[model samples]
Target: LNMANMDGDETFESTLLGEAEEVFVERIADDECILIRGTKNHSSASIVLRGPNEYFLDEMERSVHDSLCVVKRVMESKKVVPGGGAVEAALSIYLESFATSISSREQLAIAEFAKSLLIIPKTLATNAAKDATDLVAKLRAYHNSSQTKKEHTHLKWVGLDLHEGVVRDSVKAGVLEPAISKIKSLKFATEAAITILRIDDLIKLEPQKEDKKYGGCMDEE
Candidate 1:
């Protein structure tokens, strides 16, 4: 493979020595090059970036790093889900059904959690200058209907494709995301919400009168 040619894409250009001459690989002060001695199967590639200013370069680096992280996560899990909020909408429908089976106060919490999942599709619709309420309602209807038919399974992947201004199968539309990332995000969000609720309970258990103390002093002054 031509290593130099492989690096030259639309957004980047690279040059490499073509001769087979043996040259000493040495580390030098203030030099960007770092020698990597490894087998052919264990080779590494370097990226070079340039921009008009430091801010642009920083942003570019961040974006490239995030892309690589996504690739790594996808490789680790070897799994993906339909994007465009399709999974969230489907989960919302399933959770709502589960909430109906519960008889305790937990049912209300589960139902609210299910409702919160729709915010993803709602935000997508609103950002696209579409009617968020109508679009979310329609998306929810699609996923709910999927549970009734074996042949309409594709409806589970139905979500708003903002670019096309239509609801369609996101998986067929080539919109996918790393399944592990989604799982991690939902896990973190739930943990955070639980922590916040604990803090609120602690506050309620020992109500502070700090405001009243200062208010009384001000009135006397």
Candidate 2:
């Protein structure tokens, strides 16, 4: 299909590509569906997603969309980071160190905010039916704790392996994500959280003015 809006001399726009040919749709047993697309003048890519339930199918669709978005973002920035909460873990460690440099009451707030970043890994572990506490403890050591400080000092790519319920090298395990996504997500979350936490409002009702005497006089009258 032709991309509707594009500049004439744009380098990477697939705007005027020819229509697809030999397209076919097929239905298989066991609630499966497939579509095979054949483009005329370019390479065509296809994906097959099969899930037993509607929720699973929708989630898979969302994941595919997210990955495509990440790819587009990475192409624009040419920077990527290890996924599976590895990037978050690294940021959490950095924030903790940075927090120590602050010498005001804000240090405590900074430290607590840093701790909140670990929620990514914690939720990942919990969703995989693993113990979030154990995984987070291991991840803290894998990325930040002492004793391993000398050995793991420069290895900031370690992340929670949710499937295995362990803290391991996410980069080597094919877990990579767009760096910009994580940074943006963290910034937005932190701002939203701080804004919500600062809210202070109160309401009071005029304390049932003359409730008993007024009601008794009304009844008697």
Candidate 3:
């Protein structure tokens, strides 16, 4: 019973009876037997027989068919390939490096790594707490000073490359194979910390200090 324009415009106001008056006169031959109640601005109802129902149903079916055809034509006109994998791979690498930097106990290395990863857009990044913790554990185990120092040198280089996308000219010049070799030699916390700091100058992180208890020695007079 309520009618209004979709755009909220007040100017367009006309009763349904006023619009359908001509159609009703043309379709209906008998007017004396029918008693119509309600004004032009009020409510109205029309009963359709089975034949009219079938006609309306056919119209609806045609409308749906036409809509689908238009949609298919539009889609065919534009050939688009969804590049989800490329984006996913790039984001995975970025997030993995970010999490590693965050959980790193080596302050200098972590600081540098964080700075580099922050440059990437937030939409392309993942922020999972578990991943961060795991990365920290990995860094701690790989760069332990107590472990064999010589072997971890290569690992340190690889970690640096992953964090900052930077590596020695020799590694770059040698390409993927030589770079892999250099990465294999990195070992020890000092090398890891140094490499991280080299990439990010602001990573002035210090190692964990051991707690030393004071034991007083009695002075001999």
* lDDT winner: 1
Q: In candidate 2, what are the lDDT values of residues 1-221, reduced to their tens digit?
A: 55344665425446744676566657754554555456665565766778888799899999999888878999987888888777777777888999999999999988998898888888898889999898887777777753247765656777877766777777788788877876788789978998888889767778655667576356644
In terms of TM-score, the best-performing candidate is: 1
Question: Listing every candidate in turn, what is its Cα RMSD in Å to the true structure after a full C-alpha superposition?
Answer: 10.9, 7.5, 24.3
Reference-based TM-score, model 3: 0.16
In candidate 3, residue 76 scores what lDDT? 57
lDDT of each: 0.82, 0.77, 0.39
Alpha-carbon TM-score of each model against the true structure: 0.71, 0.66, 0.16
> How many residue pairs collide in each prediction?
0, 0, 11
User: What is the TM-score ranking, best to worst?
Assistant: 1, 2, 3
Ranking according to lDDT, highest score first: 1, 2, 3
Model 1 lDDT at residue 87 = 88
Which stretches in model 1 have alpha-carbon errors above 4 Å? 1-42, 200-221
lDDT of 2: 0.77
**What lDDT, from 0 to 1, does candidate 1 have?**
0.82
Q: Which residue pairs in candidate 2 collide?
A: none
Winner by TM-score between candidate 3 and candidate 1: 1
Candidate 3 C-alpha lDDT tens digits along 1-221: 34446776555444332532323223443332344444355465644323256688678777777766645644654432112112222333444455665645665544554444323222222232123333433443443421346754443322212333322222333222222222233234346766665784454679856545524444457
